[model samples]
Target: MTQQELQARYEAVMMNAFGAPKRVFERGEGIHLWDADGRRYLDLLSGLAVTGLGHAHPGVTAAITAQLGSLGHVSNFFASQPQVRLAERLAALTGHPDARVFFTNSGTEANEAAFKLTRLTGRTKVIAMEGAFHGRTMGALALTANPKYREPFEPLPGEVVFVPFGDEAALRAAADERTAAILIETVQGENGVVPVPDGFLAASRRIADEVGALLWIDEVQTGLGRCGEYLAHQADGVSADLITLAKGLGNGFPVGACIATGRAASLLQPGQHGTTFGGNPVAAAAGNAVLDALEGGVLENARATGAWLAWAIEALGHPRIEGVRGRGMLLGVVLTRDVAAQVADAALKAGYVINAPRPGVLRLAPPLIATPEDLAGFVEALPGLLDAHG
Candidate 1:
């Protein structure tokens, strides 16, 4: 069907929450997507950083096909080989061999499991960072600090406090013995790829330790090589008691996990938490494939290409670009003005895709496997896109 016809049908049948559709994509390859009219566009956002291995990866496709044919999902009643292996692999990737994992279907669900684990500490007070974007679920939403998203959903789960992000003093003042957990994103994804200040996370760890609060880092958007590391938190060398992941864990397949280390891992026993389709065999297999790609130099591509993109964008000398912030592939080009949304729309028309998490910041987290040519093309097109927007 044409894009307009499909959009019309979607609006009539689908919920109005997401508002109008932007474009209808039919197929995708590495770093590129084709719309209903077959017009191609370079994918710089990577489906909000979930397509780390890019679209239609051969290894991932093969793994999914083989696993689906053998055994897809057996529910939580029984165990699966892929599930066990994936869990162990995930824990090992975190650099904590003894870390235990609880799988879920999305990032928010993984966080929800972590939230319940926090409650097992006998405290409901959570100290989260301002400008944080946890998830949309009631529990996750409660932890999210954006007033715009939370104002409409008032009376959410309570005892959640928001402190200025990356401010050690604020965090130290807010976290006390009563705080159950201090959740943060090493790099705030939805807040325009802003990396936490140096020594900020280390201070968080120290504070959480002193106050008996769990240090939970939300790696949902920055894990699994999205930032050229197994997880963005790895760069800090500070370990979290609970680490949540999802976006890139299963590549394109839906999967989420809450990994807890040390005593935190023992908090939620069988009956305490459960998910019907969390560790389904298919999702496990997909997770394994994603890890394989990460271990097989897809991560290196993300680093190299991301660095190249950063340098190229900087060299553009565009008047609108104020600065660039972030690490590896997760980057935010901060505009001098609040025209990010318009620039994003212009980017789409110019055969590229990007997002605006903040009004003045254009965020880009392209596929980890994006070729240098694709990266260069986006860089080359960016100046024109910004010019048009201006």
Candidate 2:
């Protein structure tokens, strides 16, 4: 079918919560997507940092097929190898030997589980960053900082106080003995792929320790190699009491996890929290495959290539290009003017995929598997996009 025909079908059946469709993508390979009209475009967004292993990855596909052959899913009442193995693998990544996990279907659900854990601390107040985006669910929404997403669903889950994103002084002032948890996103993706300031995570960990509150780091967008590390806090050499992960966990297969460490590990009792099909065999298998790729040097590529892309773009001498912020594949190209949306739209029309999360910030979160050549394509076309749109 033509693009217009597919778009018409989509509008007829789908809800308008996400606005209109850009293109009816038919298929993807590596870091490229093909639309209904068979136009090829470089996938720089990676489905909002989910498909880190790239489209139709053989490792993910093989694992999913093999798990389906053996056993697909069973109730949480009974344990499965894939599920247990995945939990163990991710827990080990925390570098905390006694880490525990609660699985969920998406980042929001993972945050929901973490929220309930906070309630178990016998405290109701939560300290969140000013530009953070946790998720859209009630509990997760409570921690999200944007009024636009929160005002519509007033009377959110808890008494959440928003502090400046990287201001340690404000964070210290907001947090106290009554604070149950301090929620920090390693990188504020929705607020324009902004990485937390240096030493910010360590300051948060210190403040949480002082207040006797859990340090909950939301790694939904920055974790698992997206930002050059398995967890962004690893760079700070500090461990979080609670860590929520999703997006790239299953490489496009819907799965998420809320991992707790130290005393926070045993906070959730048996009946306190549960999920029907959170980490079923199929999803776990997919997660395992993505992990294999991350461990097999895909992470290194993200680090090196991401740096090169930033330098290359700046090397263009484009006056509109102010600079770049963020680490690894998650970057926000800061434009001199508020033409981010225009540049992104022009790029898409020119057969590349990126997004404008804010007025002057263009977010680029390509797959971890994206090579220098692939990003070079986008950088080469960036000048033209800016020239036309800026």
Candidate 3:
């Protein structure tokens, strides 16, 4: 069907939460996507950073095809090989060999599960940073603290207190025995890819330890090789009591996991928490395949290409460009004016795809498999796009 026809049908049937769809994409390969009209555009957004390995990855497709051909799902009543193995691998990634995992189908669900786990500590108070986007669920929204996202769903659950992002003094003053967990995203992607101040994570760990509160790192956007690390928090040199992951976990497949270690691991008993499609065999297979590709050499590519792309963009010396922030492939272009949205729209017409998370910040989260050469096109076109739009 045509893009216009599909959009009309979508607007009629869909909830309209995300507005009209951008375009009816016919297919995608590697770092490029083709709409139904046959126009090609570089996929810098990576489907909001979920398609880590890019579309139509051979291994991921083969794994999903193979898994579905044999055994799709047997439910949580019985154990499946892919589910068990993926759980083991995920637990190990948390740096806790015996860490426990509660699987979900999306990052929001993982955050919701983690939200419930915090109540097990007998504390409803959660310390979350301002400008942090946890999720839209009622439980996760309490920890999110965004007025636009939370005000509509007022009377949220939990005693979630908001603090200035990266303020050590505010965090230290807010913490006490009543606090359940200090939730933070090492890199606040929603706030224009802003990474916390240096030594912030370590300081949070110290404060949480002193107050006997759990340190929960929300790596949903920055994990799974997106930031050139197995887990973005690894670079902080502080281990979290709870870690939630998704987005790039299953590449494009829907899969999420909330991991807990030490005393936090045993909070959920047999009937405490569960999900039906969280770690189904097909999802597990996709996750395992992405993990394999990431571990093999895609991570290194992300690190190298990310560094080069960031440098290359800066080297352009465009007058509208202010600077760049964030780690690895997930970057935010700081613009001199609040025309990021216009630039992004212009970029879409120019055969590139990007988004403005904030008024003056354009977020670029390409697939992990993107090479420097693949990104050079976007980098070269950015100055003209910004000039025409900014």
Q: Candidate 3 residues 215-235, lDDT tens each?
A: 999999999999999899988
RMSD of 2: 0.8
lDDT of model 1, residue 289: 87
Candidate 1 lDDT tens digits, 15-54? 8989998999999987789999889999989899899888
Supply the TM-score for candidate 2.
Answer: 0.99
Give per-candidate clash totals.
0, 0, 0
Worst 10 residues of 1 by lDDT: 370-379
lDDT of 2 by residue, 1-390 (tens): 999998999999999999889889999998999999999999999999999988999999999999999999898999898889999999999989999998899999999999999999999999999988999999899898889999999998788999999999999999998999999988899998788898999999999999999999999989999999998778778889999999999999999999999999988898888899999999999998888889899889999989998888889999999999889999999999999998888999999899999999999999898888778878888888998976
Give the residue spans of candidate 2 off by over 4 A.
none
Please give the CA lDDT of all the candidate structures.
Answer: 0.90, 0.92, 0.91
Measured over all alpha carbons after superposition, the RMSD of each candidate to the real structure, in angstroms, is 0.9, 0.8, 0.9
